[model samples]
Target: MRVIEVEHFEAWRAAARELLRDGVPAGDVDFCSPSTQKSLFGDESDDGGRALAAREAAARQRRGGVTVPPDFLKRARMVACHRDEHRWNLLYRVLWRLTTAEPNLLHVAFDDDVRRFDLMAKSVGRDAHKAQAFVRFRRIETEDGEQFVAWHRPDHRILRLVGPFFSRRFKSMRWTILTPDESASWDGAALTYGPGAPASAAPSADDLDEMWRSYYRSIFNPARIKLAMMRREMPVRYWAALPETQIIPEILAEAPARVAAMLKYGASGTRAVSAAEFLPEARDLESLARAAAGCRGCELCERATQTVFGRGPSTARLVLVGEQPGDQEDRHGEPFIGPAGEVLNHALVTAGLARDEVYLTNAVKHFHWEPRGKQRLHKKPPSRAISACRPWLEAEMTAVAPRVLVCLGVTAAQAVLGRDTRALKTRGVPFASEWCERTIITWHPAASLRARTDEERRRIARELAEHLRVAACA
Candidate 1:
């Protein structure tokens, strides 16, 4: 009826199996035994001792000399192991907490090691915590030269399995992984880490570490911060490994700066040239589109997949304006190549306008959309974002000097006409605006496609084409 405590579930289970093999009757064994007070944990009042002793007596009375269930015994064995009498039992206690099912049984088990169990309590899962804790190493200048090293005692002997990944990741450097039970190292010669040393050294930094940190800071999406999810994926313990963890507080305190920092890092803005220096010699629409791909003019570009630029003849007399790029345009990085473009093309030819006769463009260059699973559905840009992009569109018009302007949708109308007007209400009529001499507001072909009927789409397309013809001569 003796109780055995080992550090890990595997060790405890091994001891239990050894006891079973030695011909000990299951009824003679009592797993819920009180832990003796020890100096390491400081002041054990034996709070759970009586409960375990009582449960032990009852189990004996119910099934005296009965064999324990293999499944139940296996699980019990895992929970019974202990490493030391520390303020907390890092290994076995965590196993007990994970394997415990019934309250009565858990209550009895807790009596033996309540403080140890409490140390393992966390809202985050144990594996994630281990991933954080076990990922270790720091650079130390020792007599043996600068060697990358790490040391941490893991609950499991998983280093053999997961150690190789770190080895391959940091192959160029010499590193040592030290655990309570074993150690491993890749010192440009052989993998040497197994039970021996309790402490290990630190890793020297590679030149790319800063670059990696900067890149990490930049790509971190502020909009997707779900505190619960972030905590789940990255427990508090792992923050030490992440260099950008320093900015996490800053991220919470001032998210915009973090986001801007990230964008600038992603752009590697060191290569950025002044606007006057970067403009193309020819200054055509295609060249402008390519240039806009590097634009960080507004925050909308931050979420967009890529910059979508207007396409078509640069020398065309008429210029057609549409809303910001839609989903297809965002992915393809070319404007007016989507369904709306298809319908508009048919109308353009039907109205006696060659595809090359007009400069096809969008009011805003970047795609704005809400991601739904694999699809990025269109999100109408804010009026401010539209206004912010007006200069680029104006630059295109100023460079090409088109005869007439066609506002393809409400967003486009707002940009060119400086007033928001419904395409349905203003279609087929020419209006005067300060930006363009004569502009016609009409349904963007995308709106017609969403109407879901061919006849309605064709009708809107016909009206759009008719307005284009009128603008061609204007």
Candidate 2:
């Protein structure tokens, strides 16, 4: 057994090459006696590579003739926690050293970063750049004319672990795994691996690269997107294989513009369907509500228990909009049938408008609520949700074509007015929005029911009746 220590990588490489060529498996070589470059090869012409090559030759000459003793395996673990290129090299050097023998006495000292790296590396294998650089394979032509090749890289090299994965996933195609240190290719049948070629040109796959570039461009989600996180998730080394790497600079440069575009996009409702095509001047509220129940325009249908359709007179001139269905409304499968509806009914009677004469509905045609105890409590919908639900309200408005709309609460006010309505500040004010004409903000009857004081209830109820009167005459 003998050990040869040399500085030049080619020295070790030449030795391994000769042993492999001579049918000597690396494991069979005994390293009981180690040879340093200064001693075994003498001056060695000061070329470390030449010294290693000579030692390998000498070892082969004595292999069957000399009694070789196994070298004791010495083990040491990487202790540094911080991530640095130098630190990475140190870790790999130790790792590769241990691969030559079964490890013994491998000591590990802890660092937070080292611990994190260990955890991450355990499941995913080593950093692809290090550990597996020397992998090479030979190209073989199959009897059926299919070309394929296979080779073994360093045991724990990142490419070796991931290369097979890429091969299996990207099966049915030929690909090259080019590391700076070495390269391997599996055409279809046999695998070829060897020392890395000169860094002349990056191995190219024009078709796949272009497809990857296009996909990256297409799937750049503007909503809730983060650039730094993306870069962290996909490091730069991977970009050499991916087509979109070249376009990343442009994408980052235009990020501000993209963000501005998203903000400008805001919560505008979907493009309006032409009233001329759908309305035809004669569609009734029932047809419209039934049509709205089948809407797939947004995800509101998936979250809400049921679509709470509008219920009221077909020819009513006055329209009322509530925020959404309450618990009772949700259970009953009707709009405005909850305690809020009872309060609204009393206000309607005081205002001299019969419940049967005016059409009542919700801004959102669904009960958006979350479960609490046994009750499904109402949850405020996001701006996007509100925007999504606006179409149904518009459809109802378009069909019923009410002369005046009464926005019963903040959500209703937002849906109709396209802005927040402070109910206390603007309860009696009338304004027009993109969806409706002669729209008035009013205290929702539910507000009256929730009031703690009789005086507060009286104030809200009086305001609600006043708005009803305004709708009746308008």
Best by TM-score: 1
Cand. 1 Cα-lDDT: 0.60
Top candidate on lDDT is 1
Across 319-437, the per-residue lDDT of candidate 1 in tens digits comes to: 88898887767654567766777888887877788765577788887788887996778888887677667767877887778667788877788777767456678776877766566
lDDT of 2 by residue, 85-132 (tens): 233333333333334342431334364433444554442333442222
Prediction 2 TM-score vs. true:
0.40
Those runs of model 1 whose alpha carbons end farther than 4 Å from true positions after fitting are: 1-260, 263-287, 420-425, 452-455
CA lDDT of 450 in candidate 1?
83
lDDT of 2 at 432: 74
What is the alpha-carbon lDDT for the whole of candidate 2? 0.57
